[model samples]
Target: MSCIGNCIDHACIKSFHSMIKRELVYLEKFKTREQAIRRIFEYIEVWYNRERIHSSKGIMSEYENL
Candidate 1:
């Protein structure tokens, strides 16, 4: 359980920080909080986990090999 928690924490924080820096934080204008939340959710669920290729996953998204 502790190992799982640690892994989850690391993945969540690292992904969140990267996404914020890549999108919202680097954007010129501030979007509404709701829009930000929706976009983040879409990026994580639709793109990062499903569509985007990850080198750590041998260049495939989690959904592809799973």
Candidate 2:
């Protein structure tokens, strides 16, 4: 069985962090905390949820699951 810890059972969250770092965070520069927040919000709500395809979901976005 998988052990439960901060990240031991949260592989998807870790994958998300890695993906965001690779695909969004590393490519952008924010001058303020608000800007970063807004951009990350947009990335998750607008891009990641509605637009980007997930391999695990087999060509559909998370939005389609709802």
Candidate 3:
């Protein structure tokens, strides 16, 4: 595993954090920790992987790119 701030082999980690911050963290509030966890899971597994378009990957979702 790579440390946070170390992007040598973890550009994907930084990119994932940036996407989560931009699309979810800065945009919503949760009443409970479980809610936040669930939403984050859904955001990453469903929306980000399946739906969101990434410009760096030619407007394709990670799943699509793969």
Give the whole-model CA lDDT for all candidates, comma-separated.
0.67, 0.83, 0.81
TM-score of 2: 0.66
Candidate 2's displacement at residue 19, Å, is 0.3
**Among these predicted structures, which one has the highest TM-score?**
2
Cα lDDT of candidate 1 equals 0.67
Candidate 1: C-alpha RMSD after superposition: 5.4
Instruction: Tell me how far the alpha carbon of residue 64 in candidate 2 is from the true structure, in angstroms, after superposition.
Output: 12
For candidate 1, list the clashing residue pairs, or say none.
none
TM-scores for all candidates: the values are: 0.43, 0.66, 0.62
Give the count of colliding residue pairs in each prediction: 0, 0, 0
Over 1-66, each residue of candidate 1 has an lDDT whose tens digit, in order, gives 356647765876798788767865577354697876787777667766674446566685556679
Judging by TM-score, tell me the better candidate of 1 and 3: 3
RMSD to the native, candidate 2?
4.6
Selected candidate, larger lDDT, 1 vs 2: 2
Ranking by TM-score: 2, 3, 1
Query: How many clashing residue pairs are found in candidate 3?
Result: 0
- Comparing 1 with 2 on TM-score, the higher-scoring candidate is 2
Ranking by lDDT: 2, 3, 1
TM-score between model 3 and native: 0.62
